[model samples]
Target chain A: MWDKRSDMIVHEQDPFNAEPTPQVLAESDITPVDAFYSRNHGPIPAITADDWRLDVSGRVERPHVFNLDEIRQRFTTHAVTATLQCAGNRRAGLIDVRPIPGEDPWGSGAVSTAEWRGARLADILDAVGAEDDPDLHVAFTGPDVSEVATPPQPYGSSIDIAKARSGEVLLAWGMNCQPLPRIHGGPVRIVVPGYIGARSVKWVTAITVIDAPTDNYFQASAYRILAPDADPGAAGPGDGISLSTLPLNCDVLTHSDGDRVPAGPVTVGGYAQPGNGRRIERVDVSTDGGTTWNQAELDLPYGPWAWCRWTHTLCARPGPLSLVIRAFDDTATTQPETPAAVWNPKGYLNNSWPRMTLHVT
Target chain B: MWDKRSDMIVHEQDPFNAEPTPQVLAESDITPVDAFYSRNHGPIPAITADDWRLDVSGRVERPHVFNLDEIRQRFTTHAVTATLQCAGNRRAGLIDVRPIPGEDPWGSGAVSTAEWRGARLADILDAVGAEDDPDLHVAFTGPDVSEVATPPQPYGSSIDIAKARSGEVLLAWGMNCQPLPRIHGGPVRIVVPGYIGARSVKWVTAITVIDAPTDNYFQASAYRILAPDADPGAAGPGDGISLSTLPLNCDVLTHSDGDRVPAGPVTVGGYAQPGNGRRIERVDVSTDGGTTWNQAELDLPYGPWAWCRWTHTLCARPGPLSLVIRAFDDTATTQPETPAAVWNPKGYLNNSWPRMTLHVT
Candidate 1:
């Protein structure tokens, strides 16, 4: 039924997992909503904007239900241009270092940037009862179900309440100046800026303030990177090598791996994103395995949560290219050389150096 | 053996772990060397300036042993006014929430600021082989041994080479315009600015460039916060947490907790320190459980690694005063409300709000 665009790579069919090609991504500064990557864990719940009701309960002063129009009328709306990246954005890169990860073989296409307009989560929560009594975590529950479950199960996760009230988190109802789409957690969803995409629950209907972390399987069990020898696919509760905020990463998107390019002056470029609201300090590009390097020009003035696009021009000889690119965030943490350097058993936080091999003709 | 200071709370018997009293700490802008806190894991090793030799080895293009005189002669001498805090500085605060931590019952007296004069660590490492070959870590070995160490095991730790080359780290031979003393690291020791005091590696004898982390007990085992039930006293290797930098924190230096003072027109003051090279942005003080917070005036013109002193005037009326002070760093992270909020097993990062109660007469 998802028939708007057919040019993207479809990794899954039922729940719709796909990403646009690198050529399409480099064509513009802000990725258009249609060409943006879709990483859905379940089938889209076709709930209308009028029918959706947001229920906030648990330890709050005011346990109330809010419709879409009421939420908009009650709180002042704000817009934020940010990037939302899947935790498994470059999961495919880990296979070269070790065995395949538990998730889909994700390439570099599982990230997208957009302008979100909605009420600040802190503002909406202020209307409720955070002032009367402080809580520890804010849990979000979406009305999506497991693929094999006979009865529908909600997808939920929690973030620190302090983070929720930080004004960056949003109860988003608009994306890219349009109504939120079902494929992208539409009608209503929560946008937790600067954290992993999993924490940004889609199709959100319930928000509960609790004294502890979420007990949902997606949060307490599935999202963590267990011990290196543990089986991630069958992970139990409470191992907790937690994967909450993303790490600094960059991807060389202009050229496909092992593709043949003409031996002459060529421009190689990609996108670099930093985690924990850190700015991208610098990105270095090397063609001969980092022996010598040149700084890539960063396309700046982007939002703090959006990715910085970097491009560098270099001449390619008629031999194999040992291209390597690394990014340093404002926090002084550098991107690892390869996926193996940061490999966990679950292979989460895959912010390693993304390389490309181009054979010159 | 331990006879230097007596007024402060002493935690250890041999190495003389002690912290200055709040009144003593608030006496002056810069803490006096004698009034400064001492945090030692072993007996202080007395090494004269003539006997001390600093060795540079491991995976280098050049390896040399330089005496104290040669080190001062070879490199340019610079001075930095910085603050150093032990990881378990406020260990006593943890017991209010959970079980008692495995370390000393330290109060809030383990931080002090000083002007240190030394040769830059970056300039020294640049001379001895990072240019010829690449390395990941720079391991620092101290001459002091633990009480139970059979063969005089030296305390050792490693830091990222990028951090070593950051230029703020120093191979110090002097402190506060005087020769480095045995109580501190001397005649030559590393001053790793912006990192924890543990990584500074007191009484440093050897600096080795390596491909991985240090194999010493302090580096591989003791410094991290384990699970709540884990044995911090006898920690094992590979727990994966290494506390390199301090957290944003503030401590009231003028008044001790539960100390009785005259009521009305009282001025409350404290010191604020930010972690990881971030400067203190603002200090917030509230005498009424944060219902209303007043911004405190901060003393400026301080180094990035040093603490910023803040003072505030408040009129205290009668009985029990619930005073809460918190600090915000430039990176936007703030101090937690209480120690219970961030209770770790080893009591490593005690950036919780340091409170003071005065029974006004």
Candidate 2:
């Protein structure tokens, strides 16, 4: 596994958390399979496509079990090109503001886009005779157990039924038109576009339709945004805002922090993703510490759920320079100017203005 | 009309644009029909229910005309309690930052919630055999014509077919359980809950399914967000972002700009709205210019599309004091801190932190 992802930046060894370099992501529209980010809460479970089984139960009228072949044969296949982002993407900025111990110090590489193909969760719900109730939730649980919880338990998360039945959510088994790899949930996983990546359970084994959000630690307590001073250790279930869809975010991917560049015309670019179905309307690049701004050209997104790649050519002078990028979604919502404005104890959803300093020669 | 709305703060007399007092809005969840804000573009059309006709055509399998009685009898009636907000609801804040000529300086009272009873647009689209295409748009036109456009054309706008068939869009005929008043689009109107209020065309005369967004000035250019320095005079059709789903916003509604208050303990409250289907997660009240914040208690919204009422008690000293409020939607998005951060030439979507100063004695 280490040899295969040698080109990526490995953050942890046991759970195999790794991400591709920023230039690798900036170079392509659809992220390459090996270069795609891998974020796991537990050791990768060993399971073959033929031996994997999916149990659909709970409020569903016809509770049934299906092998991998049955899932592929019974439901119609649909493809969606969506960008999945970890809620902790760009968490390094928050950690720099203050100490966020025990959290991954992500640095703008935990997000990537891919062409996902699979059976729609809505179709599966329809096959199982699921009722259309907004109050209900579709919970997904995986076989991999992680000690991240106080007591070891299978990793689980859930999305509201309306999102589950939106027809865009999928139980995907293929990535970039290739068979899903073992490291990325080979048999099957849930792909909830527009939501934070944690909700898209990898190695998904059992799906249950419940009346409320799943009581799993990830769904009920862990991935929430608490007050800045609130102690996460003392929080109970549903303590803070349960993060779902993402907010407008953009990052400068070409130049790493403290990079030295020749003082002349240089290209600066990055990727921007607007939450839910909103489109990236405009991207403003500020070379003079946000006192002056130039609009960057945005490439049309592959789909509503995909990210837009933006580029701009800036004329640099001989000295130190500050570069900041912010995006406005179609809804006219822009990002906060600094990470401190959005910093939390968990260091999640750091959608502040992405900045980098370049020493010009 | 003025007699009926004596309690409202009338902005325009001819087209009858007016809004209620903020205290009036804060006092109730469901705005009384008489106190509801009335925003109009042109002179109200005098059409009785018996003679009013709805012509449904354009890109549909069947084109038909329906009378009010036919509309009431042919489809199932649904009730949705939704907040309708003007894109210019908080334009006053932007205007205070800079001069925004030729625009109404609206305060925070331009948004209100009411229970609307109507036929679902999805049902209407189904009845007309409209295809479910994401690229297509459903255009709506009304008999009232506004002179705001250079050519003085009838007010018109369009929403994408996905939003049109989302089951939340309605052809509303009732407001707060009463027959819609003439000034408020008497016989029938298109009620797009989550969109900018301009898209909800009143006195609706025609509904057309089109291949692209409507060419009407409102849809094509007027409601768009242009660059700060971009000359509006030189802008063409399809320029800037066409305003649609609202951004997350909150407003302090209990006191006016210069109200004097007793020192010691005072209660401050406001309304917060999360865009589209998202709910208001948390509201923060700052008594000393955002340096410190106290979480305001949020009241349950009437529906997903409704606004959440929030309030907080503050201890004040005898001096001039500034209060600022910001809201976090379930998506973890918050308002910008200052009006200058979001000021545009058009003075739309000033969702910056809502602030007011008072002389505490």
Candidate 3:
């Protein structure tokens, strides 16, 4: 018999499982929540508030445990609306060349912006009496676990010693003015605003200061983006890089090929975010290849972790047109010219310029 | 500690839980999956195929029970890709005038599309032997038990004898070319292609043909959308009307105040779906309120149960502009002119002309 719990409301499509096909972003600067793509590894957990707790241990001078109420009351809270893009957000575009092995073959839904509020991790570290140890990596673990045949380390990741101490990291307790729901990490969870979400562990169970990087499976094996030149099928974990922060470049693509719009004028828009406190200085759109470029309108100012929306209007001409958009950060890091040049085995961190073929009739 | 399953991916938003605040649907076609919205009452369940079954009983000439394997072997399979929209898909737009009791405050994500496949319910009914009864209602029961203080009726819904006999209903065993995932009613389920998804029961365990309509809570009280003139908050078991078939109407509204586009050109877009067997005959859009209208381009052919994507382009001109899109069905039933005249207490069906304010520079 179908379980009542499984009596789910069905929609027109598998809303969560579809691959991201390139489409122009809405004209508005802030993406409506439904339009934001989702990136998840499994089903949303059903968490009960009564059973939740946050444990703080390891290299701390005072190891203490806090429930949801205590964590909310003992710390000063702040909010920041930032864009959280999965390191592998647009992996499908790369997979079109060759299949990549791993979890979600996500399209673009992996990126989204939400107002986050919580105690800064740096503040919590200070409260716990952290020591200045160069070798220490602040490791965060979640209640979520996956079985490994080889007794794999628990699924968890860590931030570098400096970033953890920057006082910018937050132990988020709320979103959009509401207590965080269990689906999005309820009670208390970590929010490293400018970093990839992998390090922002949900359902956080513990914070441990270790002398070395986390040995967890999620730390050592997964969440690592292979180098651009790495072999597709070769596996040795060679020089694979762990994604500790967001990428510096922004890649936005639009598709109008089969879309029918009258010939005269058209507007295309999307959002871009840079990693490591880098702000987007400008966005350029090219109707042809990069041979020619035009400045697009920046819809909003750069926020600490939020993506900036950009738009451009093009006079319609009757013909097949190629649309390309690339953004540069204040640090001068621009999106790579093409995906082929930056294609990697795991299809991670694909910040290549997005190319769209459209008919502007 | 967090359950390992907590990491299960959340692919989309609950559409009815919020409103169209910043206006996400651009061009009215292509509902982004993450933004496509959802309406579910409980946490997704964990179901295993080995323990699943589909039972057929009641007023049949030959009552029979089929396990997952037996159901798979006994029926010839077919597939259909259709759109399933919840009755409450756009209820948020109506909350300002009159509020409904106990219903979820959903925004716009309650609709989605997917390819569904299974043996025809007609075939199964014929296999088990259909009695020569003309007034029987086919009842479907699922395995979920309610936890509310009120004793839960076994979750079930019914279709009319004519609908059951029409040979269009299906006992869906697959979705999008894959075995139905447990969360989506794995081993076997139902697919009432042109009907509301709530009628397409998941985790189906039994099917019974009774002389009277289903007495289950869902069929008796839950799914009905009261008439616009009905009293607000009057939907109780005694006062509530049974939710049978959905009305054939389309409602698509825009949230922006008048904003002008450059005088060269502009594009108009929105989504349209006929409630039942009704096919969308034509979609007309107007840049000047209801004064003048232009025919729009329809994307795909009308399926027995799916939404069509429609778009139109307007020659831009300088003025305060209001864009309204209306749909005509095979039956020639058009959407209401305004929400106020069609608003209902239960907020069931609110298919009115979608109006968007825009300006042409």
Give per-model TM-scores.
0.55, 0.92, 0.46
DockQ of each: 0.02, 0.50, 0.01
Q: Of the candidates numbered 1 and 2, which has the greater TM-score value?
A: 2
Among the numbered candidates, top TM-score falls to: 2
Q: CA lDDT of A53 in candidate 3?
A: 74
Model number with the top lDDT: 2
Q: What are the per-residue Cα lDDT tens digits for candidate 1 across A1-361?
A: 5434668988888777898887777777677878888877787789999999999988778889999999999899998878888877888787666776446777788887888889999987888876444458889998888663223357888998878888788999898898888778889888877787889898999999888888887777766754445566666777635566676778888888888888888888888888765777667787866545577898993678788999999898898876788775653344545564445566566776677788988
Q: Which candidate number maximizes DockQ?
A: 2
Q: What is the C-alpha RMSD of each candidate to the true structure, in Å?
A: 20.9, 2.9, 26.4
List the pairs of residues colliding in candidate 1.
none
Error of 2 at A234 (Å): 0.6
lDDT of 2 by residue, B1-361 (tens): 4225567888888778888999899889998887778888788898898989999999889898989898899999999999999999989888988888878888888998989899998998889888667799999999988998757999999999999999889999998898887777878999999899999899899999999999998999888888776778888889888899898899988887788999988898889999887778889887777756779999998889889999898888999879888899877888777777677778898888888998899
After TM-score superposition, the amount by which residue A322's alpha carbon in candidate 1 deviates from its true location, in angstroms, is: 2.5
**Over the stretch A104-220, how does candidate 2's per-residue lDDT look in tens digits?**
898889999999999999999999998767799999999989888656789999998989999789999999999877777776999999999999999899999999999898888
lDDT of 1 at A129: 74
How much of the true A–B contact set does each candidate keep? Answer: 0.00, 0.48, 0.00
